[model samples]
Target: MFGRTKTSGKTSTTAAATTDHEVREGAKGRPTPKRREAEQRNRRPLGSPARAAAVRPGASKEEKKAAREAERKVFAEERALQRQALVTGDERYLPVRDKGVAKRFTRDYVDARRNAGELFIPVAMVILLSSLIPVAVVVRASLVALYALVLWVIVDSFLLRRKLNRITVDRFGDKATGCATYGMMRALQIRRTRLPKPQVKRGEFPV
Candidate 1:
């Protein structure tokens, strides 16, 4: 080092401005490190700093596995947050497909309207069970009724979708995007089981 010694020696030749623990090298091969200095240097890792170093690259299979595990942990946490939002109606964490005033209004409107598609499953089960009864007339009647119910569900769904589209346009204008199918699907779900946990009751709609 082109520097003077911290504490001046009697035989020093460098200027007074340079002062540090380092010995001034007038011309040298290399000075032998002191015992403590050598030990400390050996102990310290050869790097810039421990904390300041960038994240290590995935250099090994184990490291890659650890990175993947970290990524999976983050994904699981995000999914958990979204699930909580769905059940608890936490707006901040709700997916984009379920957000905005229009979507909320659509949900409320669908919940408020009584759609026949909601009853299709239960009615079908009843028809199937009734067919088990030992009566040809009863079986025929059940089959006929099931067909009628299916037709009614289709008609009701059509009406429900139309209603949802009109509501979206009326409340949000033509510029607003529509989610008639989403609203229709929600309508088929029982109110109690619907996600984002229905904020409004059957009669108390947002729009």
Candidate 2:
């Protein structure tokens, strides 16, 4: 029979104890972090809806009123500036009604001329009022004068168109197509009522 090997429980228990000590030593310096504290340190908030409310929300009565008032003030300021520019004929803020070098030249040409159409408004008012006269001779005379004046203005406009065409063709070449018509219309307007209010005075012709 083979000799039986001696076994000691002390040897087994000592080996297990040494293994446990090694594991504890490895984890001694580094403590496990708490989930709650880690989360708080790295927390992310939602983006800027509160700041957006100041610009987009006007549902309350006072807020709505304030928004409308602000809008009106802005509109009033724009109107005032536009009117001032129109009156002073500021080129930087000139309206669509009076933009472009061609238009400027047209205005200058019309203003410089001693045309019959300049007194058109008052003359037309007088002629229309006289046409209301019940007397046959006076009515007929006013109608004839009206026709004559219309004819004269038409003839003058034709001459004005030719002259503007010639001048513009000489200066701007192929771009004189609608400039004559534009100039003619400007010529017909009452000098006092023209918008962009004639920057050039009479006799101030621009080339």
Candidate 3:
């Protein structure tokens, strides 16, 4: 009876040890952690902004200010690059309207020639000032001249559109929509002021 009791005690001790081992294992990996614990672990992990703010209270302000200055420098560089792209015709930074081979081709075509439409802005300015004159003859002549200039610009733009359409169709197997209008608009802008600044020099016509 005594030996049997001793054996029972040993078996109970072994069972208790096994149960403790299982509990330890479960704590390590078996079950999911409580929500609060999990969230705390996730919210301020190493290298996170929140972690940095918490761990470095004394230096955080200076670090933040330095970080902001760095961001500003990066933004300024990007802005400069975008402006340069506008002048150099860099596709990566070009606006949506200026992106694409057809658009580039149209721009080049318009830039290669001196358009009559470019004179419209200056001429209209002159006509406006002349119309302000008290003299009746000057006002009437300016009105007539304005009408003639408008008609001439329309005719020139139409011709340009037709030529652009024909050329695009020949080259690309189909005419690109809005390309003619795009070309005409660019042609009307003063050469020096054109965006995606004129890739081709005057008289360097595209084949």
RMSD of each: 14.9, 17.8, 9.6
Clashing pairs in model 3?
none
lDDT of 2: 0.74
lDDT of each: 0.75, 0.74, 0.83
Residue 106 CA displacement from its true place in model 3, Å: 0.9
Better candidate number, 1 or 3, judged by lDDT: 3
Kindly give the stretch of ten consecutive residues in candidate 2 with the minimal lDDT sum. Answer: 45-54
Q: Best to worst by TM-score, what's the order?
A: 1, 3, 2
Write one digit per residue (lDDT tens) for candidate 3, span 1-207. Answer: 999999999999999987887788435645678998897677653444544544543666767677556666666777898899999999888877888888888899999987989999999999989999999999999999999999999999889989988887677655467788889888899988999899899899887
Model 2 deviation from the true structure expressed as Cα RMSD, one decimal place: 17.8
Question: Please, what is the TM-score per model?
Answer: 0.64, 0.58, 0.62
As a TM-score, model 2 comes out at 0.58
TM-score quality measure for candidate 3: 0.62
What digit string (tens of lDDT, one per residue) describes model 2 on residues 142-202? Answer: 9998888888888888899899988977877665557888888877888888776777767
- Candidate with maximal lDDT: 3
Give candidate 3 misplaced runs (Cα > 4 Å). 1-76, 173-175
The alpha-carbon root-mean-square deviation between model 1 and the true structure, to one decimal in Å, is 14.9
Winner of 2 and 3 under TM-score:
3
Candidate 1 on 63-89: residue-level lDDT in tens? 656665666666688799999999877
